[model samples]
Target: MTRTRVPALGAEGWFTLDAETPALLGDRCTACGSYAFPPAGSFCRNPRCASTAFATVPLSRRGKVWSYTDAQYAPPSPYVAPQEGHVPFCIAAVELAEEGLVVLGQVVAGVTVDDLQVGTEVEVVLDTLFSDEDHDHLIWKWRPVAAGGAG
Candidate 1:
């Protein structure tokens, strides 16, 4: 049986999956130039800017680690553990310098907090978060930037 590749239901409109280099989709406030993730809302989030227009845009694919930690325990409801059961993973808070935004994501599989540092550079990548008989639920993850700047 073939399983379909699909983004997690809650993540729709937050990213693009078909591009060679997939990117997170965000919305920039037309008035203030500030960006927001998940791309939802009719008005700008900036308190000083009253303008309501925004344009969907792709966010930076790379950023520096602002912080990171190990998740030794499984998450609560709505999170499905892998077939082998819960395995420890690392979570990172990466700061996109261009947007001045910090995004949180799981570290790519096989990488642990021991391999990362506060300022380590990382890039976004898509991977299976979990799977069902019919689908592989994909989600964004962070991986240390390879030498020479390739993601």
Candidate 2:
């Protein structure tokens, strides 16, 4: 039996799960060039800019680690743990160079706080959040970029 895939969190247009390289979807102000994650619609997020037009944009997949920490406790609602219960996980805030924005996500399974450092290069990858009999929920995660290799 195969389990269907789903987004663990109900965010539409936030990221793509079907691309060769998974990328976070963002909205860029056509007028001010400001970018926002979760793809802002209907308005420019830049306060100084009065334009409401936006273009859907794929965010940079690679970034430098800005900060990181371990989540030892189960997260609050909207996050569901597996049947085994809460497992410690590392979360990282990565700074995208072009956008100059920091996006937070969990590090790939098996990654830990000790395995990361500020300025370490990382790349976005799709990962399973949890699985049920009917579906395997997916989410974006960060992984250390292999040395001298493209992400």
Candidate 3:
């Protein structure tokens, strides 16, 4: 049996999976150079800038851990829980250097609180969220940067 891969949630153009290197996508205000993830549909988020034009840009693949926590309970609707019930998972907020913004996402599987710390470097990677007999949902996740460097 073969399982089809799909995005766990609705497509919002926040990231691209078809590219050779998957990357989180963002929008940059042409005027102020401010960036926003999930791609800002209109207007610059910078209060000082009046420009509404933006260009799609790929966000930094690497970042430093700003904070982290574990979810011990199942999340609310739209988030499909595992068939076995809630499983605690680590979540991390990483600060991107060039983007100058913090992005939050789930840490890759097998990573625990003991394996991370503030200032630890991490990189984005694709991982399976959950799967039914016919489909496997893929989602972006963060993993600790290896000793050799970014992977």
Candidate 4:
């Protein structure tokens, strides 16, 4: 499911992994042709230029696993683990083409640590981190990529 509200940091547009919207989000520097995810809220990190105006750019959904690990124990405050049962979640860092940067997120449903390895191939997937009675916090996650021959 895609998040409906506009992103708060760099991009003014909302994010989604729905078939209709299957791109990661980043801010493109109008000054330079660089992009940053989670939107570079502060300023462009590129050392070569000093520009402020940023445009929302769609990122590639598929990437190769740069590295991975799992949270053996529940994370502390701010991370609200489900109350019903403690489920260990796998998080991965994926490296995209052209960007040369690594994006980190959780593995999707039906995936586990046992299924992951460094340099594995992965694709971005949108999933809910949690939902209260009122709203759901949607986030981008990674999973084994089908085309990469992941098994």
Candidate 3 lDDT trough over 10 residues, lowest sum: 142-151
Ranking by lDDT: 1, 2, 3, 4
Global lDDT of each model? Answer: 0.85, 0.85, 0.83, 0.72
| Structural similarity to truth (TM-score) of each candidate | 0.92, 0.89, 0.86, 0.81
Q: Which candidate is the best by TM-score?
A: 1
Ranking by TM-score: 1, 2, 3, 4
**Candidate 2 global TM-score:** 0.89
Model 1 — which ten-residue stretch has the worst lDDT? 142-151
Better of 1 and 3 by TM-score: 1
lDDT of 4 at 103: 88
Local accuracy of candidate 2 as per-residue lDDT tens digits, 66-133 = 99999899988777886577889999999999997999999887788888999999999877888889
- The lDDT, on a scale of 0 to 1, for candidate 1 is 0.85
| CA lDDT for candidate 2 | 0.85
Q: Which tens-of-lDDT digit does each residue in 1-151 have in candidate 3?
A: 9998777775447777753467788999998899998787788878899998999998999999999998888888788765677778899999999999899999876778988999999988776777888988778888898632332
Off by over 4 Å in 4: 1-14, 17-21, 147-151
Worst 10 residues of 2 by lDDT: 142-151
TM-score result, candidate 1: 0.92
* C-alpha-based local distance difference test score of model 3: 0.83
Model 1, position 104, has a per-residue lDDT of 94
Clashing residue pairs in candidate 4 are none
